[model samples]
Target: MSSILRRIFKGKDQQHQIVIIGLDSAGKTTIVNRLLRSEFIPTTRTLGVNYRTVKYRQIMFSLIDLGGQEIYRNLLWQPSLEKADAIVFVLDSADLRISEASKAFWESIQQNENAPVLFIANKIDLPGARTFDTIVQDLDLTRATRSSRPVGLFRISAKTGENFYDAFDWLADVVVGSESVFKCKLRTVILIDLDSHKIWTTKFSSLKNEILDEFNRSISETMHELMKEPAGMEVIIASDLQLVVVKNHPLVVGLIIGYSDSVVRSKLIAERLMNTASSSIEIGEFSSDVLTKLLKRQWPLDIYKSKPRSD
Candidate 1:
C-alpha cells in the first residue's frame, strides 16, 4: 500500500529513505546523531519518529528514526518500514534483553522483503560487550537469512567511532547498486626495501600459513616488478586476495587485503598507511616493534587495542 520514492538529483547524487529501528535503549538515536554530526551525542528515548535528511558521499539519506518502545513500535513501525529504501537495525551489544530484541526485529521486517538490511551491534566499547559471532548467533541471523536482500552485520561502537565508517560505507555502496568496495578487509601488511627484500610484515586476521606464504610471494613478485619502475602504485588481485603495491622511492609498501573488489577504497587506505609510515618511521631504520606500533596506531580497531572487536 505504501511505496518509497527514490529520487535522483544531479550527477551521482540520489536520495534514499533509511529507517532506523530497534528496541528501546538500543542506541538508535545515538547512531543517527553520530551520522548527522560525526560526534558522540547522547540522546534520550525516542517517543515517536524523528526524521532528518543527511548527505553522505553524495547520497541524501532520509533517515527516519522510529521510537523503539513497545507502544510506539506497535503504532509506527509498519509505516516506516513500508517506505524505507534501507533498514538499519541497531542492537545494544551489552544488553541482556536480546531475545526481546530478536523478536522485535523479525516482526518488524516481516512485511518488508526488498529493502537492504544493515544489522549493527552497537555499544561495542562497553564492558561485557558480545562478540560479533556471539551477537550474530544470539539474533538468529544466520538461520533467518534473506537471500533476496543484501544483509550486512557489523560490530561497532558509536561512542569511540570504531568501525563506524566501515559499516556505513558498505551500506552506502549497497544502497547505490555498487556491490561493496569497503568490504576489502586488511589481511597482511608488508614493508619492502628497494631491493625487494622484506623489511617487515604482519598478518591481521587468522590465515593458513601456506596461504599467507603464497600471498607474501605474490606481493614480493609484484614488489619486484614495481621496484623496476621505482615510482607510482599498483593493485594486484590474486583470486580473493588484493595486493596494493606503493613505490615511494627507497621504500615499497605492500598491503594484502582480502575480498578483492576494486582499487579505489583499498588504495586510499594503503596511501594513508604510507603517509603514517612516512611520518612515523625513517626508511630502513625501524624495527619490527616500531612498525607494529605504527600499525597499531594507524588502525586501533584492527589490531584491537581494547576489548571490542570488529568482524
Candidate 2:
C-alpha cells in the first residue's frame, strides 16, 4: 500500500526540522551517527552541534545534534528549540546526576511548548541503567502529559542499535505532514468512528477550526439520514469549499476539499482513507490520536520535478 501511495505522490518533497539535545556523554552523537550512517560507528563527544538530513516519505528530516555540556546548553538550546518542529531529549539512564541536570535544561524552556518531545532514555546497554518505568516515574511523566506538549518515552541503546528504527519511526510519526507540499484546493482530512463519538482532523485553514465541531455534528446527522444502506457519502458543496465522504462499516473517512481540487485526486484520497480505517489495528472506541496518525499516511503531496530536497 505504501508502495502504491509513493507512486502517486512520488515527486513532491516536504521538509521538517528536528533537533536532538541532551547532556554531554549522554550518547547524543552516538544516536545521530547510528541514524545517518547505516552502520554504528564510534563517535567522539561533540564540541558544539552536528547537522544531518535524511529523506523519508518525500520529507527531509533535518536532524541537529546539539552539544549537551553545561556551559553550552544555555547558548545552544534556545535557537535550536525556536526552529525545531520536534525535539528529542536524551537522558543518561545510568547516571542519575546527568538525568537531573537534563531535567533542568528541559524545564528552562519557555517557548515551543507545542513541539512534540520524544524523551529517549538512552545508554540502556549499561548493566546498572535505570529501567524505562523508573525513569518515567522519576521524571513525573504523568504530570508532563497533562501539559500541552505531546510527550513520549522510549528506551534505546545507541551502541547496539537496539530499537533504532522504532525510535526514528516515533519521530517521523509525530511530525505532522507539511502544508507546503499540499496542492491548493485540498482543505482537510477527518476520521471518525460510528461506534464511538470521537474525531481527528488535519485542516488547511483557520476557518475550518472555528466550524469543525459544528460541521462534525452535522456530518453525523447527515450520515444517519443519507447512509440508509450503512455505507455511503453525505456531502455539502458550497461555492468556495466542498466536502466528500467515504465509509466502510463502523468507520467513515471524509475529505473537505476546495471546489477547485481535482475530483480524481480527491476520490483517490478518500478511498485510501476508508481502506486504511477499515483495516486499522482496531476499531470501536478507537483513539483519535491513533486515527490522526493514520490519516496523515493518506495525505496527497504531488512531487512536480526532480531536484535536491531542501528543508
Candidate 3:
C-alpha cells in the first residue's frame, strides 16, 4: 500500500523554471545570493540574464535573474513564459515611484496569461521602504488578481532575511499546488539530526525511510553547495502538503502543511520544535519510534487536524 501510494504521489519533483524580474538595482542578484548564502553580499548590476538553480527539497528551482536595464526591459515575457511554471516579479520597495514599478510588473505578467506571479517587495531594509499593504493599495494588486489567477505579493528584505522563507514557501507551494494534491492539513513534522542524519516523522506519513533519507542527505548537501545553512523559516512547498523546515543549529524541524498557516503558527511552532529538539537530545539516544511517541505526546494528532488560521 505504501509503495502504491508513493507511485501515485510521484512526479512533482521536476525542475521548475522561475525567473526573477525587477528593475535594475532593485537587488535581484542580491536577493538570489541572500537565498543562497543567507547574508548580503555586494553585487553589481546584471548586464544580461543571470541563471542559477536553487535546489530546495525535492524541486530544483531554475532561478533566471534577468537584467532589468532599460534596454533589456523591452525583451517581452512571452518567450520566458513558454516554459516557466510561475513568475516572480520583484520590485524596489524604496523606489519613490513604486506604482510605476507595479505598472511594469502587471505589464510583464499580462503578456503571459499562463504563469501566476509571486510579486516580491524587495529591499525593505533600506530607508523609505514601503509597507506590504501600501504596495497592494498603490499597485492595485486586488485589481491585478481579480483579472488573473493565483497572484500574491509579499514584503521581503533579502538583505536582512525578513519574510523570505514565507514568500519562497508560498511560491513553491503555489507552483506544486497546481500539479497534485497538496496536504491542506499538516502531514509531516520531520525531526532530523544534522549531525547523524536520522529521521523522525509525524503520523499517517507516506514517506518511506529511503525516500526520507534522500530529503535528509539533501539538507546538508544543499547547505554545503549554497554556503547557506538551512536557517530561517525554511519551508519546502512540496506537491503534497507544503513542507516547512525550520533549522536551529543541530536539529532541523520540517513541517508539511496544506493551508497557509497563520504567521504566528509558521514562525513559532517550527522554532519551538527546533529549540526543543536541539536542547533535549543526547548524541546516541535518538530513534524514530521514540521521537514519534514524544511528538504525539507533545503535539498530538488533533493538532494536525486543526484548521490553520488564514487571516
Candidate 4:
C-alpha cells in the first residue's frame, strides 16, 4: 500500500508522494493512465481515490489520484494534500467552466502550503481551448507566485500527448528538490554578438522559424532599449514563454524558457554562460555545435542529480 511505502521512505530521497486532483473530466486520471501505461483508454468517473506506484527516472512516485466530485473533496482531499510532496492541479482548458474550476483550484491548493504545484491546463489540443494566459488570469495564479512557492503552469493535451512529459519532468525535478535555476525548462538559448552583429542560437524543443524570429526581434529590441542604461539581466514574461536576457560587455545572451519562476536563478545561469562564451572564443566565431554544447553544459538534463549505482 502507498501508506506503507510512504512510512518506509518517509525521509528518504528516492521516493516522493505526488497528489493529482482536478474537477471531473479535467483529464487527471487520463494523464496518469498515459504516464503509467503509455496509452489512452476511456475512463469512468472516479468514485473515490486511485493509487499507483510509478518509477520515472529511477525515482519512485506514489501517485494519488483523487476524485473531483464535491463529496470526495469534502472528505478525502485534505489527508492526501497533507502527505503530498508535490501536487498537480489539472484544468480542462476547452471546457466553459473556468469559474467553477478556478474556485476548485484555489480551494484545493489552500490545503497544502509546502507542496510545489504543477498547474496543468489540459485539453489544449481541442479547437476551443483557452490560451494559457487567459486561464492564468481566470484562476488568478499570480497570487501563488507572489507567495514565493515554486509553481509552474504548463499547457498540455492528454489525448495527443503534446507537452505531456514536460509537465511531469518539471514535477519530478521539484519533487527531487533541485536548485530552482536548474529546474527551468530551457526552450531556446541565443547569444548575440554586439560587435559583429551576428546571432548564434540553439533550441532544445522543436520550434517554428517564426517563433525563433519573434524571439530574436524581442531580444534585439530589449537589448537596444537597455543599451542606454547600466548593463545587467532582464526577464520578460509573455504568455507561456519567459525570455531571460543578460548583457555583459559585447555579448548579450538570451534564454527562452517555459517556467515563469526562477528569474534570479535563470539570470545567474545566463550570465555564467555569457562569461564563458565571451572568454572562450571571439565574437561571431561560435558554430552551431559549439553553442549547443555550451548551453547544454550550463542547462543540462534536469533529472538525475546523481548516477544510479551499477549494482
| TM-score for all models, in order of appearance | 0.60, 0.52, 0.61, 0.57
Best by lDDT: 4
How many Å off is the CA of 165 in candidate 3?
0.8
- The numbered model that scores best in TM-score is 3
**How would you encode candidate 4's per-residue C-alpha lDDT over 1-311 as one tens digit per residue?**
59978876764446688999988889989988876765566798888999988755345788999999888887998999988888899999998988888888888888988889999999998999999989889999888777767898899888866666667767766777674334455677888777778778777776566766777777767777656644655555454556777777677788877543444455667778877787655644677688888766666752123242231
Off by over 4 Å in 4: 1-13, 179-311
Off by over 4 Å in 1: 1-13, 144-146, 179-311
lDDT of 1 by residue, 156-259 (tens): 88886666766777888889776444445566777765643547776677766777777777775665567667465554545555566666776777776653
The TM-score, computed over Cα atoms with residue i paired to residue i, of candidate 2 is 0.52
Per-residue lDDT value at 157 in model 3 = 84
Q: Using lDDT as the measure, name the better of candidate 1 and candidate 4.
A: 4
Which digits, one per residue and each the tens of the lDDT, describe model 3 over residues 107-179? 7887777787888888887888888788888888888777657887788888766788667767767777744
Q: Rate the local accuracy (lDDT) of all candidates.
A: 0.74, 0.65, 0.67, 0.75
Can you give the lDDT of residue 260 in candidate 2?
Answer: 31
Candidates ranked by TM-score: 3, 1, 4, 2
Clashes of each: 0, 2, 6, 0
- Spell out the clash pairs found in candidate 3: 182-240, 183-240, 183-241, 183-258, 184-258, 236-243
